[model samples]
Target: MKELIEVLVERKQKNASPLPYHGWVGPCTQVSLLYDGFRLGDASNYDSVKSFAQLMWPDGHPRFCKSMHTMATQIEELNKLIWLMIIDSYGLGEKWESVMINYKMLVQFMKYMAPPPGVYERGLFAHTDKPVSTIICDDQVLGLEVEVKDGQWIKLSLSPSSFCFVVGDPLRAWSNGRLKAVNHRIMMSGDNGRYSIAAFVIPIEGTIIKAPKELIDEQHPQLYKDFDFMEFFLFAFSDPAKHIDSGEQLHAFASLSPPISN
Candidate 1:
């Protein structure tokens, strides 16, 4: 994360503009500059597939906060934890993700009444940060605009960077019969202001990633297997929605279902 901040800092020092908000449905092939600790897309498993965050705008990555980026030598603390993630990812074979969503959105919103930034892609999904926490907002909905998959759409009266985490379904599947992926998202605030930063952490592969053994009883044994990161990445990228369902299609690594022989 420190490295990410540094990259941002360097750019911001030159009076760079904040990176545009890349909506959830981003170009699957595009890459961004604001990189948290986790690798982006999983195209392959044997070798860690290098993927980057989708570019927010043409010149910048995301909302760049000059004040935050200019803070004390904060890079040291960030480097340490990243080391662990690197170790687990490379040495331990633990499939995982870790990220920090800055609060630039809410900050800028308070200044102007223009259209707000779109939700981050995969930003508000089905995964929760460990250590258990919640994000509350003061951006009350003064007026209703539209309806989405599960909730209402309204402008939030908040700052620019009110970042949060949403536990995704993919992690749940990877956890075997252990961890439960949580469904989540962000709502537009209208009356008040919100300020927050969300950091998401996940594990690496080669290890049989699964839910806590306690979650599974005798009635429900382990449902997932120790999968290759590349194998799983391929399945996920091709069809994120389909990868979550249970059946032969869900676990078809190397064409193992009907046509391909194991």
Candidate 2:
């Protein structure tokens, strides 16, 4: 918490683009107190798409033991390392393991607005191509959109210190369609636009992650099949531009991709 807060303060001082955020696994899910978020998913085709920054990873279950909470709260790296294990390592996490993750919700939001998965999967981007979503915000700000084509891009607004997650297509591949990576983009907002930072936890290389015994008790045996995190990360991060708007994809890539600025 100390290190995370320090970084946030520094970004504010710099008036950094989109501002910066520090992410880790904690007792409660992080959310914004002010800004609203969006999700977009439209893969059927349409060269590109976008949305707000978000990410997700299962914490398994919240800690009831005070001692465990104390340890996690004190050690920031533990929070980061655990997440790395999941994404980069492909989830070596067993019971009591917390995962660090990040992603932009814009893609999921766009997917929500666009036709369903089946619609786009059928040769869509080739026909009636679209530049981006029609967007409007409470206040226009810089750093809202990461980059632009033609004239502009789609940007999103979110409050400081708050974070969310998006499901990625790579996950869908790894999850065998159980989870889907979102396709989204920015709409070029002016205010509430900011930079973000996340420290995703990961395990060592060559560890093939699978569902733990706890999440899948006798009644529920292995809902999701197992796979290698390293391979999944490669598939997910290979073309970030393909899914930059998705917090889900970003969260999935946390274990694989390096920090954007530092």
Candidate 3:
């Protein structure tokens, strides 16, 4: 992982194009992976054709490419299992099985070093993972923080082998507000540097993301209108102004119908 971080930093130093993040946070480098677990899936063909690893790592980095492929593949598998469990918990297991869940995984490597004394801390601003979910694997340093009730930011303590999960917009809408898509931020400490690889789990672009019929009853009214995953994804990256904070864009899709009478 350290070697991968070195490559990312070195490439960024060379002015490689950073992922356009709608001006939300500072610069970072990422490589999107292929394979939606189906041959000719066409779910990630556009990205896979680009070969992000080859583009970023370039020559003399066979190990880097190999590692990226291995990690992305493993994470994709994990993504499916986790999604299955999540939907099943909401009693949508049988319905979910009939629909294929697609995801585009990215190997994001960020390097955060302590800023000079007395300067305003420079780190990623508070935001939510816009996809289905994010599986974060951080090195020793703990710079990640989650927003709890009352808007308090809580620091995380992660072990070397532990991975943290952050829920995302799609699931929150799909679950009719039953699930929580946490608001989180990164704060680099004055004495340590941090690096992490996060797999941003996205869903099938064409899938309509609305609360399942079975999950929505008189007691559990639909909170959000039906929306396509790709549309929401594009909206998020298209304009930071629209979504300046967590739940802003999502709230835009709120359903206004009166609750169903029991």
Candidate 4:
């Protein structure tokens, strides 16, 4: 982990050019480089690798690409373990196994430039991830914050060896809203830049997200209707104004018809 962080930080210093693919999204102080496992073995991966190699490392440093690929594979394995835990805890192994096949993973490397002295900036705005789950390996710079149930934002102090696991909209909906999708953001402060890597586990395109029958009872009625995971993802990103920090976008996209009786 430390080696990967060092490599990314060194690359960032040596290359100030815009990122390939989704170049410089969100705040100007933040930039992201993404590697999607789903694109592997396809024409898209070939083109993406060519573009990334040319734009980021003109000299074609194979070590940088190797490091990223290695990290993505590690994170993919970790996500599988976490997913098994979730399935066992919720007893949705059978139902989930059928629909959740061919799950895709995305690894994102984020760099947040330090804000001006004594000023705090929103490097990435507050929002909930649209995937099933996300695992974040944050550096020691300490700018990640999460909103608690009481509406208080708590800054996380994580060590270099630590990893933060966060629930996302699809998982929350799959468990019949029993699992809460956390609202989180990167608050940039101080003079030191922040670096982090996030691995997101997403369902395959057109996977119908629905709660298993075992999780629904009189006490916990069906909260979300069956909806396409990719469709909801597109809906959430299509409109910036509709982006609510509390995961209301999921409700808006997949709430049950006529509402559930209280």
- Model 1, CA-based lDDT: 0.30
Tell me the TM-score of each prediction against the true structure.
Answer: 0.33, 0.30, 0.78, 0.78
Provide backbone clash counts, one per model: 46, 63, 0, 0
True-vs-predicted CA distance for residue 23, candidate 2, Å: 20
Ranking by lDDT: 4, 3, 1, 2
**Candidate 1: residue 117 Cα off by (Å):** 13
lDDT per residue (tens digit) for residues 107-218 in model 2:
2111111223333211111110011111222222223233234534344455643343333333333333334333433232222232232222232456454444333444
Each model's C-alpha lDDT?
0.30, 0.30, 0.62, 0.66
lDDT (10s digit) by residue, model 1, range 86-183: 33543342523332211111111111121235422221222222211222222332221222446544433444433223333334443342334433
**In model 2, what is the error at residue 237, expressed in angstroms?**
5.2
**Model 2, which residues run further than 4 Å from truth?**
1-157, 165-185, 190-194, 217-219, 237-262
Candidate 4 lands at a TM-score of: 0.78
- Cα lDDT for residue 181, model 4? 93
